[model samples]
Target chain A: MIVDSLPRTTLTEIAGMAGGGAALPALAARLNIVEMTQAAEDAVLQPKDAGRWPHALRAALAARIARQNDCPALADRYAGMAGADMAVADPAVAGEAEGLTLVCRFMDKVSVSPRDVAARDILELQEAGVSDADIVRLCELNAFVSYQVRVIAGLRLMAESVA
Target chain B: MNDVIHKFTRNVPDWRPRVTPVKLEDATPEQLDALQVTPSNTKVSAYVLTLAHDVETLKVRSPLFNGIMYDPGGLDRAARELSALAASVLSRCVYCAAVHAARHAQLSKSTEVTDDLFANGDKADLTPRDRAIFDLAYGLAGSPPAATPDQMRAARDAGLSDAEIVDAILSSALFGWANRLMHVLGDPVRKGAA
Candidate 1:
């Protein structure tokens, strides 16, 4: 919900999805990694695991993190999707108390500083009605976002030098 | 088969994470298949079993991991492992750090670099070439904002081909996220309980 859009060029617009950097091989590599990322997101956010974690919840949590990380493009898309299903976002609209609050809280830890998280922190999620499977999915989603944000940001940096 | 098959153990238990992984007896058929063997057809390890708690995601995760680490087109296994170690070091993930460090030493057969890296990655004994991976990956993993073109240039200066550098970024970024998951899912123990 707090995800604000920032103006920028998307990788696809810049390089036809794989955006070239200085070298052909480097460009290929970035494109390959980006393709994997796109595929992974489609798998996670689409119809596959709907029974466990809804697409909406995934969107909300994803948007929250993209916002936290300053990924405007990703934040805008996921936040828009999350808007419909946020039946009861926290007072801060930050995903508290709702089963998602637990996800948001934990993932926020993951986003800011993962080293500080302890077993007790995970237990709080379990107590909040998140199953072990859901917990794993949350971790997967959060971690993937971390990877995605960094890769894109780094690639964006590489893209700037593109001709 | 991956060496992790033989190396899996809960020995280095940390009291920090408390989620119980699905043990062998409780594993599902899907997990049974997944935990049964490594890519090389050797017996799988407790690590796979532990991950069986969420077999579906593991189904999705393992192949990607294999592609990045074991796929044909990227950095050699040693350089890939080096990138992983750099990220794990940044995440301060003991479990992953231990696993990848051993792999780096085995693949490179260069104990001095591996040991120095493990001891203090901030200043490993690598030449500018090898050091490029550390520079690029540390910033990439710790804080993407901190990562800059210089890190990539540094990797290039160290004599890594563009593809190698790409692999370096991919592997390091993978661990940046992965280390976080491992940290929350469970803590690493030095040895399994006897």
Candidate 2:
């Protein structure tokens, strides 16, 4: 499980800042935010009710997003949770074998070019028979992964600066 | 027909969800808890209702969002708003941009910064500090997160303390999360049009 790999220290494992005590002080002041961030990661990646997307699929998507953002360590951590759905973690796979080509395309667009997304994108999903609830679930997963990627990137920069 | 707003504005736009929102009457106990709906606070926006479909994330996301954007100290409110606005602009999340821009203008007590931003985008003329903050946020909001050590140094040189810089990262990164849901799940249309 993704939660199993989480470090006890706030923002340390996710941001790959272990042994760097410099950024700890700044992070300690906002410990609530840090803790809540972990809670959010759990909620999105492995929610009690995962809706249409299972935990393994969510982890694959999370790993894919992390790679898209060039965060290999974070990607590797999530990849461990991907189980049998690991091929979906590669951006070049296109998800055809998994019957998720459309889903993959939608996620790629939303992740890299959200501004270009429009009503038609949702329409296509609807036409493909994806439920409204499932659509929301997919988006929450994609959105949370996007947020996590940037936070990891930012935290690394913070650690580097203070180091 | 109500027009979908394509340009950046301080006038907040209404968000119309493409998916069916969870009806309040049909909401499960868990969804109600996530929505935080009390009798006195029964009113909820369409956006919130749409998000109620994924109650787990909604539950934790709300508190984390508030802590990053509204917690005392760290980055000043206006600076945090600026970081949010920068991310919104980069993602072209019109609804998020307008709302944060308005908040930024209100907090700063002037439209000068948002006005310049709306008119010129990344080339908007800003005070050195605002420039550094905006640039850092814009870079961090990119798909691969283009923020570099130089931008971090620029923010420091612009007088932002470490705490303030961390706040900027959180606010901007929070919007990176927000923009996908807002821009991808719905359309930003004129008020009452949907």
- Give the winner by DockQ: 2
Q: Which stretches of candidate 2 lie over 4 Å from their true place?
A: A1-10
lDDT of 2 by residue, B133-179 (tens): 99999999998899999998888899988778889999999999999
Q: Give the Cα error of residue B182 in candidate 1, in Å.
A: 1.4
Per-model TM values vs. the true structure: 0.80, 0.96
Q: Residue B36 error for model 1, in Å?
A: 6.0
- Residues B1-194 of candidate 1 have per-residue lDDT tens digits of 11111222212333223565676666667777756554576555555555566565566667677778877875789888878888877777777876787787788876677677756658766878778777787888864346777777676666777567668777887897788777777766534331
Against the correct fold, how does model 1 do in TM-score?
0.80
Report residue A5 deviation for candidate 1 (angstroms). 27
- Candidates 1 onward: DockQ, in order: 0.43, 0.74
lDDT by residue for model 1 over A1-163, one digit each (tens)? 2212221233343322333335445545444444556666665565365556788877777776666676767776776776666542222465444635566667788876887777778788778777776677777777877777776665665555333
Fnat, 2 decimals, each candidate = 0.50, 0.84
Root-mean-square deviation per candidate = 7.0, 3.4
**Model 1 steric clash pairs:** A95-A101, A119-B16, B11-B191, B11-B192, B12-B188, B12-B189, B12-B190, B12-B191, B13-B189, B129-B158
lDDT of 1: 0.66
Q: After aligning candidate 1 to the native by TM-score, how far in Å is the CA of B18 from where it should be?
A: 2.7
Residue A150, candidate 1: C-alpha displacement in angstroms = 2.0
